[model samples]
Structures are given as C-alpha cells and as structure tokens.
Target: MNYFFVINARKFKQYLFIALAIIFSAAIVYSEQSNVSVFMNSEPSAIYSVQTEKKVIALTFDISWGDTRAEPILKILKDNDVKDATFFLSSPWSKSHPDIVSHIKSYGFEIGSHGNKFDNYSDLSDEEIRNEISTAHGILTELIGKEPNLIRLPNGDFDKRVLRIADDLGYSVIQWDTDSQDWLNKGVDTLVNRVVSKAHPGDIVLLHASDSSQQTHEALPDIIQQLRAKGYQFVSVSELIKQTQVETTPVEDQAMKQIH
Candidate 1:
C-alpha cells in the first residue's frame, strides 16, 4: 500500500508541472499576438475634435449644391458677430456661384473643400478619390485665392485609404462631433436642442448652408444664442484643430459619428 501511494504522488507532481508549462506557453503566445495587433492597426490622422478644456467650438457649413441658403447663413453670422466659421465648398457649386463664394471669402471665414463629387469616397477607387480632392482643391484655390487645407468628405463618408490620400495631398480631414441634422428640416426646436445639448469643449458642429437644409438659417440664431449662454465660443475649424493636441484612433468609418 505504501509503495502504491508513493507512485501516485509522483504521477500527480508530473501532471501538475505539465499543466503549468502549457499555461505559460499560452500566455507568451497571447502577448506576442497582442503586440502584433497593435502595430498592424495603426490609424491615419484625421481631426474630428481636439483635446482641450477651453469653451471653443467650430461651426462648419457644407455647401455642395446651393446658392440661396448660404447668404442667409452668412448674414446671420455677420449679425451675430460670429467671425470664426468655416465653409467647405464643393468645386462645382463654387464654379457655378462665384459671387456667393466671394461673399463667404469676404467674411474672412476659413474655406475648405467639400470634395468635387457628392459620393462616398470610401466606395471610390483610390485614384478616383485623389482626383476628386485635387480637382476641388484647384477650383477652390482659384476662387478663394488661397489654398484650402481642410476637407469634409461628401456625406461624411471615408475610410483609411481615403484619409491616406488626403494626407498625401496636404489636407487635414475635418469631421464633426455635433450634427444639427438641419438637412432633415425636422423643426427649429429639434435642431436647436441637438446642437445646444451636444455642445462641448473642442466640438466641431456640423451645420449645412446648402439649399437642402430649410431650417438651418432659422435655427442658427438660437443655436448661437444657446451655445453662448452655455459659455461656448465659436472658432474656425482650422483654429479648433490648432488649439488641440491632435490624436488619432483606429476607427472604421467615424466621419459621420454623432455625439450622443
């Protein structure tokens, strides 16, 4: 019996050692895989918002196809003395309405590219994306007499490849954290609440000056008033980017992400 007991103890010790060795090997393999994943998933840079505590926000308007809506928005900005706004103008629209483009430029508002085609860049070929951005850049530069360094993809659609191409062309892709959804023309109250409630430091507010948005011009006054009452000051998108220490993360499609 004593001899059998000794044999059983020896077997138990051996099995325990094998189990610990297997666990250690698995841990090492997991650590290596994690390191590889971190390197492989590095994301390109895009400015959605900044990392700052200041009460600053950027009121950005996208004008893709419109002549009527922009003027009212411009007037509202001027009346409110809100000088730090950004307008991303599509090349085609700017070509058709040079006078309005001039008015926007006259206000000293920072102009950016809204891309030439109103299509999802993530769905386009890499070469096609490059052409769209470059074409828009040339047209806007001629109209504004200054090169546009910022861009907001049409429909706010983009992927990592699109970001890489834009970066190569000397553009910083600007995305918004707050969306007024005025394009829906839901109501002046809904638009106002969407913006005022979501307003935060270093926020980029997406509003449209395109004709599709019927209520943005009307909502602008209340939006500005409420934000100011909350202690948020408006800045140009470029200024907002400049004010923060930029950080990028690996996200699939976050251009249209809304702050909830």
Candidate 2:
C-alpha cells in the first residue's frame, strides 16, 4: 500500500538526466547574456603597453611644436646606434621643419602622427577630433610619402569618444607606460633615472623631442646604456605591439571584469 505505484529505475534516471540538461543549458544562456552586457557597456581604450615576457621596449618621442629639440635627439640616437625608435610628429612642426623630419626618416626610425594641433582631443567635438587626426594624417603622408597610422594624442590625453574617433580614422592610439617626464626640463639625472628605473618588458617609454624637453638628448645615452645592460632590446612601437599580446580596457571600466 505504501508503494502502490512502483517507480521504474530507468525512467527515474532518464527524468533526472533531462532536468540536469535543462539547468546546464540555462546556465550557459545566462553566462552568454552577461558577457554581452559587459561588452556593450564597456568603454574604449588605447594601447598603453603590451603584455610580454621578452626583454623588449619601445622608445617613443612626441614632437608637438619645436625646431630646436628634435635634431639633437636624433643625433644622440644615431651616435648611440639606437635605430629602433618612434617619433610622433605634429603637422605644424613637420611643415615648418621638413628637413628635420627628413633627417628622422633617413635615420631609419619609425614615424607616427601626433595630430594636427597641440590641443587635447578629449575636449574637442567629434567632428573636430576627426579633422585634427585626418589633417595630420594627410600632411604627414605627404611629407613622409606614406600615411602614419599610429598616433599619440596631444598630452597622451583621451576619453572614450576620442578613442572611438581615432579608430574610425584608422589610427592606433599609442600611449606610454614609462613616462620620462623630460618635458619638465628636469635635470639629466632625473630624466635618466625615471626611465631606467621603470623600464620593463613591453614598456613604451615616453620621451619628448620637443623644445620643452631640454634634457632628453642629454639623458638619452645613459638611458640606452642602462636599459641595454638590463638586457632590454629596443624596438619601434609597431614591433613592440606586434610581439606582445594586448589588453584594451577603458580606465573607468577596468573593474568590470571582477563582476560575476
């Protein structure tokens, strides 16, 4: 009487298997939805540095406006036999000093765009941002005979909108992991120390080839020497990025990955 209706063992197992399959399928669907949400709401990012274990670094110079500073830096690089560097050249500066730009090209260093103006792209209207990058691209392409696809925004400043606009214009926005702070006109020792102390694998070291960075040329030799001693090999920004894996998370949404 207690088990008037006997249950078949095979039927019970089949039912249990069906229920578990449904739950697993539901979990998968929920997970996919969560991923979609994160992707949709996340902000854009620039390539600040890459992830790699190789002893490689990228030395980048930004020349926004200057005639006096770039040549000395180029000379030091040449004298030191450091050919793997990148210079982000602004349109105005490139126009006024085409000869210096030509020298940079002749030295076999890489060239990237520093945009058309020294103003912050984050503060510009979307249309203005596009114009600045495109105009610089046009000028540099004419001057260098090929379009520079890499850019470092004026002052390394950008927001989500600026990043999106740059990407639309076919630019890979480059930023720095190790800032030399040479623009402060700090002493040669300070500039050298800042860069050498923080240098690491896959680092993009920021040095300036503008008039404001009075001591960068002075410090370049030592920076190169110390980094080389540490077994770091210099490469252009493109080469550095190519050899390493990259992560592109916005500054604000960096914590989004911690959520379930």
Candidate 3:
C-alpha cells in the first residue's frame, strides 16, 4: 500500500469515533425539525400550521401600522392569562413604542419580526425584501435582546423568492390557517366565527394588535373561550412551528397568502 494512503490502526479508530459523533449531533438537530428532511422544499415554504396530532393551536397578532390598540390588547391577553401568543412587530412600530415593546416582552409573550415597513412583499425585488427583513430583524433583536427566528410578512404578502430569502436569512415564514378578517372592520361576531369555525389542531390563527383590526379586541374573549371549550391548547407561533419538523403547504393558504 502507498504510504500516503496508509491508515494507522489507532488513527483509523479515532477517525471513526469523530464520524460517529458528528452523525449523532446531526441527528439531534434533524430530530427537532424532522418534517424538513422529508417534506419541506429546498427554498422553504411558509408554515401555516404544524402537523402535530396534539390539540394545540397558536394565536398570532400582527402589529404593523397601528398602536392604538396595543395596550388594550395586551391587557386583554394579560387578563386572560394568555401569555403564550405570538406578536409580530414592525420595526417602525417597535421604534416608536419601545416601552410597549418592552412590556410585551416582559409578559413572556413570544415576539417575531413583521418587517420594517409594511410593504407589499410580492412587489418587492429580492434586495428590497432583504432590506425590509434585515432592518426589522435588527430593530427587533435590539429591543428583544434575542434573535427572533420567525417572520410574518407585511400584509401576509409573500412569494417563493421571499420565502427563500427568509430561509437564507435564518427565518421561518409564518402564515395563518384561520384569519379573523378583523382588519376589514368585520363585525365582532363575524371576526369571532371566522376563526372559531375554521380552527383545528395545529392551526395558526391570525389576529391584529394594530388599529387595523378594531374588532379583534371585541371578538378576542369569545375566540379564546370557544376554542378552549373545544379542547384547543394555545401556543406561541414559535412553539407552534417548533412542534413540527417539515412543513407542508396547505391547499387553502396557496390561494392568497399574498393578499393578507
């Protein structure tokens, strides 16, 4: 055997041990997100919900253009003792209301990025999208003192490129299975039913903490109780995403995930 190709017995055993260690470490990381290995596309797809059999769901609030309802909504969630909900904050909003931003964090509610400006993501070029997300992620992390790995696009508008860019930047795109339509000033009852009727285990329900969704405040109590009555467990969006490994595209979210 050529000397250069020869493997000493002790060195071969050492190499084998290192190879097994690396494989074990990879398994641990992959296990946390197993669905990624089998189902997620290379470009990454939005996670509308998890695939867990557990009767757990997530309630997410978008805080993009308005702060009029911030305190009130926080009070409502606090009163209900529902602190696990996710709040996606726009950089502009968080900049203006750092105190309120801090308050949300103090409650131990999960916070995610909502982009810096509420731009129509589908209309943005790749660089524009990067600017929007990077700007927001920086501001959020500054206030949060921790990196937030989840993002809900402004107006819920996104495309494959946006998802791919977000994946590259280390963010998982979040969407909702049940939208309250509260942004439309939909009546309280309408908002309530829109969510309660369509909700399922692993569902992500989108609401708003901004003034855009005035009816959300009115409809929230009922939404919480009714879903609870049905045996649904509330979780943060991060927790919801963490529950599943590979995310599959849902039939309905495909139609207008860009339209909010």
Q: Each candidate's lDDT (Cα)?
A: 0.88, 0.85, 0.83
Off by over 4 Å in 2: 1-44, 251-260
lDDT of 1 by residue, 1-260 (tens): 99999999999999999999999999999999999787555546667788799999999999988678999999999999999999999999999999999999999999999999788888889899999999999999999998999998888787888988998899988888778888988999999998999888998889999899999999999999989988888999888878878645455654433311
lDDT (10s digit) by residue, model 3, range 94-189: 999999999999999999999987777777888999989999989999998999999998878877778878988999888888877788885988
Best of the two (1, 2) by lDDT: 1
* Tens digit per residue, CA lDDT, model 2, 1-260: 43543456667888999999999999999999999788655545688788999999999998877788898889888888897999999999999989999999999999999889888777788999999999999999999998888998887777777877888888888888888888887799998999999998999988888887788888999999999999999999999888968745465521111100
Output the TM-score of candidate 1: 0.82
Evaluated at residue 86, the lDDT of candidate 1 is 93
Order the numbered candidates by TM-score, best leading: 2, 1, 3
After superposition, candidate 3 runs with Cα above 4 Å error: 1-41, 250-260
Candidate 1 all-Cα RMSD: 4.6
Question: Candidates' TM-scores?
Answer: 0.82, 0.85, 0.80
- Candidate 1 regions off by >4 Å? 1-42, 247-249, 253-260
Better of 1 and 2 by TM-score: 2
| Candidate number that wins on lDDT, 2 or 3 | 2
